[model samples]
Target: MPSSVCIMEDPPVDRLTSPILKKYYPCPNASPGYFSLRHKFRSLFQLPRIHASELPVQQNKPVSPADALTAAAESLQKKVVQNKSLISEVEIQQFLSSETGSDRLKRMYTKDVDGFQSPELWFIGQSLLKICGMTFLITSYIGGKHGGEKFAKENQATAFRTQFQASRLRNDHVVLAGMKSGFIWTYRVGIFSSIFLFLSQSIAVYRNKSSVMEYVIASGVTGSLLKANLGPKGMMSGGVFGSLMGLVGGTLIYGFMLMTNETQEQRHYWNIQKYLEVQRELNKGGD
Candidate 1:
């Protein structure tokens, strides 16, 4: 049994050398502790080592057509909900009937009046007052003292006759003749004044460049001046020139007053109509 004694010892390091095995071996000059600790840490944690093929490749996510449509519908519904009561009829009516609305209407138009008010009386009074003042100025100032005296003397007889038979003055042949002449002159002045005022107001409205009241006043002044300068003379001379001016001035003034008043009233009516329209719209709902 003691024929052969085989020997077992560590393999020669130099004889077992290989390039791949070299990595597993410690460097000849390096400390073995450093490599030992690194190996121990890597083994303890078992940290994952990544490879290019193992990485997740990112790609754009696909959107379904139905999902997009659903999103659009949701957005549309949100908008509709937000604007649901935007044109409410009740709200519009309340706004129009409010104090603020009344104030605005007042500024744009005229006062709202109920019951009976005599526009006829207002026109007549304005006409007469304006005529009286105009007559005095033209006869006394513009006509000169001598012309004024002549007018007074001529009218003196008519004046006396009027005083005695005031009721008959409208019918008496002599007085009627005088009145006829006066009426002709008055008619001419009134017509001219009316034309001037109408044209002025119409132009202002058409252009929207000037205020209606401004044109009214201009027409008034111009009519008065024209009456004073170019008014007729002869039998109706005494204080009559200024009277003619007043007549014309009154015609324009009163006419304009009535016109503006009526216009304002119409505006108020129109606003009421607009309110009704808004109410109708609100009733329709969900536009």
Candidate 2:
């Protein structure tokens, strides 16, 4: 048998009909050179080539602290101005003119105005101070009377009645005992007066009216209750005396307010007006 001759041939050109295959495999008849598959695909996809110069370049500039702060402040100010513009002058005027129940209460109490203490605390403190002064004066007068002999005698009598151990009652002991009595009286008076004033003020706030009548009613009720341990006659006497005192005090206060022309509503109005004016000035400056 004759040996068979080996035969070699190139792959068929028809096999490279696909663009991808044609890109990878060049025809045998073509010249020997590099054919970039990348460019070929780029052209096929219609992608444009970009140069470095055509790209956007950002330069890093150094900013000073002051400039940064000023920029931030300007932006904040602009935001504030925009917010303020949303509130019209007519709305502000309406808000200024209108008074709600809470506003009236705050005005009556003067809670947030002009460094004034709260009404409850102020009245209670005043009552405490008044009681303390009265107690000091009365105790001093009693202790000094008859060279404190009378007070010493009274202390002895009290100790004897109470069956307390006997100590030779001295002038100092008498003074101390008198002070104790004064303290008790002060506590009672201070508590009662504070309660009376608080009730009167609260009633006035509730009714949205400040007048003498509320004080009179509060004092009468408080006085009667304070003396309830006694008989009806004591209550009646206390109520009458309290009412008279209330009338005098209330009249004096009302007269003072009238003379000074310093009412809560008027003060609040002025404060609001000033605030509105300041805001208007700020808006004008912003504009």
Candidate 3:
């Protein structure tokens, strides 16, 4: 009878209601909160990031025409409006008063026939000298007399000449050939220089540098060293490459020197010029 009574009393069920059990039991239903908020919190702590190798990578989506147009419009608007950050009034006045700044500003705004010609002629002369210098240095180091003789022979064979019968008959063919060889070599040097300038322009943009001067210097130095390593046969090829680099470096240095004296007006002009270029690029993409 005692056993039956004890069983019926629920065997001290209140003992199961101890604070420790009660605390763990019921597990207060964790109200499933915002999944996105939880995910964000996880990300913030870098706690549950999926490994890159765990999932298939999705390819980058191509930018749509509408997105491109919107980007261009934004750029154009940003540029057209005066951005005081790019050019301030105090800086402009200072640049305008400076000799170098004045000259650069003039060149940008007004057409000066002489201004363009002077610089062009100077560059041409420099290129010619560079070609001659490289040819001498490389040949002297390698084949010595033999290399000189070979160059002469090649020049004589390949030199430019008049197509007219009368000119071809002249006894001065050798002299004309030599002159043509010089001209051809000069033209090659010029071409290499132009290529360097174009490449460095892209580099400057990529680096977000205010000046392309550093690229120019680095290219020339690298090209010279590389050419020197190639021996005598590389004279023509290496010289052209080196000259191109030199021109770029020289131009960068020169431009920076001038930019040092830039005033408020000069800054404003350059800012506008940069924006216009951005607009042109945007237009190209739209088309």
Q: What tens digits encode model 1's per-residue C-alpha lDDT throughout 143-169?
A: 344443455556665654445564343
Flag regions of model 2 displaced more than 4 Å.
1-120, 140-147, 151-169, 231-233, 264-287
Off by over 4 Å in 1: 1-174, 208-287
Best by lDDT: 2
Number of the candidate with higher TM-score, 1 or 3: 3
lDDT by residue for model 2 (108-155), tens: 566542466654457557777877788766865564454367655656
User: In candidate 2, residue 59 scores what lDDT?
Assistant: 97
TM-scores across all candidates?
Answer: 0.23, 0.46, 0.27
In candidate 1, what residue range of length 10 has the lowest lDDT sum?
Answer: 1-10
How far residue 37's Cα lies from its native spot in candidate 2, in Å, is: 88
Model 2 has a clash total of 0
Predictions in order: lDDT: 0.49, 0.64, 0.50
Clashing pairs in 1: 134-242, 135-242, 135-243
Per-prediction CA RMSD (Å): 29.0, 21.2, 22.7
Error of 2 at 8 (Å): 99
Model 3, span 1-287: residue lDDT tens: 33222111111234444565334333343222433345456557665668879999889989999999999999977885744334445654554445353344344344333334223234445765676667545443443344355545655666455546433433245444445565555555545555554444334333424354545554664465457657765755765676575666667665774678543234445644554455556665678
